[model samples]
Target chain A: MEDQDYSPKSRRRFLRKFGSLGLGTLAVSTGLTESCTNPTKDLESGKKITLLNSKNELVEVDSAYISNLNKDLAPNHNSESRKGLPGKKFVLVVDLAKCKNARKCMDKCQAVHQLRPDQHHLNVLLMKDSEHTAPYYMPKHCQHCDNPPCVKVCPVDATFKRSDGIVLIDNERCIGCRFCIAACPYSARSFNWVEPKDAEKYKDVAYDIEKNVPQKKGTVTKCTFSADCLRDGKLPYCVSACPNGVYYFGNEYEDAVTNGTSGETVSLSELLAQNSAYRLMEDLGTAPSVYYLPPKDRTLIPEIEDTHS
Target chain B: MARLNTIVAILIFACSLGAFSQTTAWEVSADQATKKNPLEILPKNLALGRNIFKRTCVSCHGEKADGKGLIQSTNLIDEKFQKQTDGVVFYKIITGRDKMPPFGAMLKEDEIWSVINYLRVLVDPSAIPPPKNVKLELTTGEEIKSITAIVLSADSAKLPLNEVDVHFYVKREFGLMRIGEMSNYTGADGKVKVVFPEKIVGDSEGNVTLVVKIENNFLYNDIETTAVKKWGTPLLSHEDEFNRRALWGARDKSPVWLLLLANGIIAIVWAVIVYVIYNLFRIKKAGRIFIK
Candidate 1:
């Protein structure tokens, strides 16, 4: 039966019927042909098939040589998600002076990333540079350094830095070694010691490396610079959620950054120079993409509420 | 007992005064309250007022002007609010109390009057006159980085329309960025010229899309025109940085030295294993030959 189907007369009849249906049906017929025969070996069959080429012009090629492209195949999330947005070098500027320990950014980050209450992708820390200096609330996230220490220490290439200056982790590839957690100077990464939040709900969902959703047990997770949101041309979940205008995010190449709360776009270079912006732990030489404006002339002073046991 | 009664009466009187102050009407002098609105209740003024309300007041006044915004404030559509004289409302807006910031400093005098005209229409939609069609022509100046907008009646007469508020905006990635000052009205000749700000970044080719609009005019409503001009600084492309191999890059983009050292170590270890296996086969063969 297979031999009869591949015969010149029957194959030509089949081709003629599919050719009349246009490119749409032609694709289906090609897929059917690919399932039954070796496409490469039968390339010299000399039977012609009409198809639209890349230039949108109709062309004829040997029917046997027509390879079926699995157009329905899911995007290679692991590989493609690792690639950064082209021509974009994302940077985040956190104004320490503006942050009042609202923790709104942390809440939004945790909610979208499906993290537990304790697991924070973004955390607001209260810090005093010196004994006499005033303490300020600092919202810390994955620095997404140009020379990321976490990515360097990953034994399994689970974590990677995209060209756009976003550091993302493929939980599917994470061995839960916690090497990245130790290597990170910022203590940004969180380990899923047990089943992740909503693990059962996301059991069947395909893993998104960009968002790091549908997290698995024994995997490391951290801020992805909101790569998924960036892909949609939106401010990151945390940045848009803040009420205090503490964050400024933009493309480094554009030389401009927009305030999250005010939606004001300003020259990034001028803002850095004017505000005397500095990165966290600059002496560590991580080359962090996240810049911090010193907590000077604070609009809201940090009020520490003691939690009694 | 008489002394205690007098003190108690004084405390009660003070409490009542506090309550009265809370519910008291916003103060507007007699002169301000009786002053008549200077601007006519034209649809154009209403539209302009509505635009200003949305940008400046919507956050607190709510989209419906019902005062259900993030910050609870007085509902402009309420019967009591609508009953106030235009001047009274203008006084309240210009001299805001606790939460409401004074618009007097931010808005022009004419703009404030226009907002009152808009508030009137909000409560009485029937007051809005029918909208007329208009045409907008945009011309870019050659010598200067300026755009000129000409507003005219859409009808065959093509008579230039004066006093129409022409708004200028530049298209941005997130939203439209207003280019010029507010309350930019066409002169008697029905033309408005606005110079573009320098140092605005555009696409790679420095092409900025300029939008000129005559929005919310009582006579002519919602006319707009767009033109692309090479007036902005070209955005610096970071394609080189994106493609450069670095220590933090993805596996495929890892530094050349790192890749070589890592792969070279793996190759050496694997070669040693293969050499040991080959010698084991030779030992087995030698053992068999010795037995023979």
Candidate 2:
């Protein structure tokens, strides 16, 4: 039965049946409501409403079946966002070799989070390990550490690490204390300082813990690893926006990561082993979810002037 | 001071020149431009090339080959692009510039040539050939933890198909995890075997669904088959660790010692305050009695 359901033919049939059933219920409810509101109106008015049927054909249905759905029925994501997705441990692999400071990931991330110009949930830093080492562009996000120091230092339980290997901040509960920011070695967290960008626009918007939008004043905000997108089975904003294919994100439990640019999925263990991938500040024992492949054989050389301090 | 200013002006001009050069036409070496395309412009080859182009190139180069995809790229059917020798186009693809990623590592030499052939057909649709289909049959060998794929022509003759690239993958949450090597083409016998890697985690029941596919093949339409096998080790769930008392755990899951110590200290401080207030009340009552 499970196998049959997975078949394309059966799945399409199931969708057709389900779609009609939903339409029928909607029609009945709207028709009943109309009769209750005004009994004098003729039930057989013969009004027609255009609708795209399940078969992708334009068909006219009785107008009685249609009703305006004014209410936004999106489920409140606040409480559920705290709990992590089960049976999965998300990991991100940043190929430093491929990063050419495209800044597309940063732009998309900042736009979605509604951060100010100076604020950054994800930053591409120019780094030189030593005087002899070549400089490279490193896009750093919240490590979403398994042993997060920020979580430990948070005065309030506002900052937390979910079971799915994501570190999130609940601005609603935050006291505007910057202890987490100070504690974070990666400098991943940022304070709102003043009001967040476009505060008036998001005034009526309910705060989504996953997206961390409707950001409160003075509260700290950091990368949620695009938790909202992950819930919808989509790649993170940064992961999908990278044209350089620098990001490879997937569940560590599956031991696989799919490259954003090339759309190629490879074994996580083998990729790490072969590429000699290393975590940022591994000696700190942060146990970061983000791994980095060295900047060996870089695609584009960094300009000498851009490397100046 | 005058010399310093002159040097800085020269540096600024050099930087602007560097930036301007990037917008110019892509350069192709004379030797690279003269090289010949190895793949023939046959219908089968074009079909295979089209399949690959659709999978890899269509994202950056629009489905119509009009350079209007997710990202702006050179249109394959553009006159300037079409005029380029097949080798020049191949060289550009192999060694990408700017936004275009180098396909050298991802695609095999034959696959790259096939894509170039497909580009020609895009410029002239008359080159597209008739289609062919193939059937894939998968069998698992539990003892050796291996999977064998048999490819055959879809016609009644059931002739075995060879030189078809067979890709093996295990279904994952976000995407498919490729197994074995990238180059797993079938031999003349129309069979290819791949041994599953050791200690791959499956479901709690230790069952994994393996997919065998003849994908992006030039001669045949894409075909695939799947089978469930008890080849993987059972996944060890981390729910216990998540629920366990720790520093990083949720409020309710805080460490027992920390919870006890914090609540214990609060209780002690409050008890002491209450005792002192009670003693003060007693002293006031005694003073009233003496005054009376």
Candidate 3:
């Protein structure tokens, strides 16, 4: 009675009874669930609630648990829980005149958005009416059409249009059916064929809902018109990337627009009138947010073969 | 009586003949060198120049003798421009330099010179000394002839022109005729110099006026601009599309890959997200389930 000692039986019984629950609950609560170690009495500080990140680097965070939390990782254009911010219509107009096929915009965009290599939110389509004349670069992203065929055939409303005219996807709900990819007229949609290494390279990004952070595998993506930058009142990467004042961004409500840089505001209608602007694939009537001014006088960017000389 | 009659007749004839001889001397040295002043004597040539200038130049350079034109054609008054010599002007008219589009095939050499001469009058209408005796009402048009303009960035000029816009306006007024056109844009240089060629006829009376129109880049702000120039009559239209094409070509002619390469970033970012999500789900279940 005086030397009533604990035996391994009680310890093993305790582990067996509460090991799955107590340890699991603590692991989840302490943000150590992802490290794959039991939450209790783990020796490594990697699992410690501290300022260290997954890479064991010092990172400033609000909570110690947050240090281990993968907050920034996002999926592609279709995040499972992303809904566009309300009360503003986002629009983009690409002036073929300003684009020079410089990849800097692409690089900055990929860097900020953490894109997979050889894949893009915007593609420089080498456009040619015929081979004889000149080939120009047509930057094609999701037109974010007013009428989205992708939305129409979604079977489930996985991809639907927002009030502000953004066509978004619920990746959590997306079946990876790729119906949207096949339906898009601009060929603006892309499929995730394999796990992107570059995505993993930037795995520790703090996700932002506007940017669809911590992108996961097996969903479709497209150009989101840089809505995040627009909200911040900065021109998107493509607009700023163009040295030639080609892309005119503006509010349809304001009826005004400016070339990507310089912020030269002009009447959108007047701009179209003056430039004889046209939209890409107007016949299909996807009603894209992006407008195209006809390649009237000059070539913005020529093909690889023609630019050789 | 006969002697008196002869004297009176001789006096009248001699006076008139003196005026005729003064004018005739202009032609005697047409190709040679005998010019004291061509304006006083060569009325016909001066008239021809004036007419040609009206016919050709008035359209682009305004009626005010500024670089602006009635039709807002290529500005002769561009501030960035260096003045073209009469020879250069003549050469341009003939060879069709830049947007001029080779009027050589359209206009004769003599016509080119005449137009140039008329433009000179537009440069300074006051320079054309009036006839010694007759009364002429000299209502001078806007004096800015050919102009070369450049836009300096606000920072360059130490001006807070962070977001300035510029507009170019062209107005025309004939004998009760009026028309107008406008253009706007912005640049880092922060300035655009316009030129109205002396070749324009709007410098003359009762012609159109072309003037510099500028608006700041910001839409809500009232256009802050430099003073405008005015050109007189002879509304001119661009006979060729070369200038418009060339200017637009200069602007839109960047390499395509740069654009594709840049905007393509958004696409890549999207790819990353998709790649991530594609790997997030559990496939061991053989199918899928939605709990929420």
Top TM-score hit = 2
Q: Supply candidate 1's per-residue lDDT for A77.
A: 46
Runs off by more than 4 Å, candidate 3? A1-87, A204-209, A299-309, B1-292
The model with the greater DockQ, 1 or 3, is 1
Summarize candidate 3's per-residue lDDT along A1-309 as a digit string, tens digits: 213223543323323333344321221234434332332334434443333332334433223233333243332323323445443455677777545565555666666655676768777667788757677777777788866678767766666665456666655566788988888887877667777546766567644445544455787766666766665666677766654455677655334566654444555666778888777777886787787876655533464565655
**Per-residue CA lDDT of candidate 2, range A1-309, in tens?**
666656764533433443554432232224434443343335545786666543455655456545665432223456667779887899999999989887889999999999887999999999877777788999999999998999888777898888899889888899987988888999999998898999998876667789888788989999999999989888899998876678999989878888876677888999999999999999999999999999887657675564456
Off by over 4 Å in 2: A1-76, A306-309, B1-20, B24-29, B38-66, B90-96, B99-115, B121-128, B187-189, B248-250, B269-292
Q: What are the lDDT figures for the candidates, one per model?
A: 0.78, 0.81, 0.51
Top candidate on DockQ is: 2
lDDT for each residue of candidate 1 in A196-297, tens digit (9 for 90 to 100): 888877666656788888778889999998887788889999887776568989887666787766565666888999999999889999999999998876
- DockQ for each numbered candidate: 0.18, 0.29, 0.01
Spell out the clash pairs found in candidate 2.
Answer: none
Docking class of 1: incorrect
| Tens-digit lDDT string for candidate 3 (B166-205) | 3343332101111122232233544343444333334223
Off by over 4 Å in 1: A1-79, A93-105, A124-138, A242-248, A258-279, A283-287, A291-302, A305-309, B1-62, B65-121, B124-132, B214-220, B231-236, B245-292
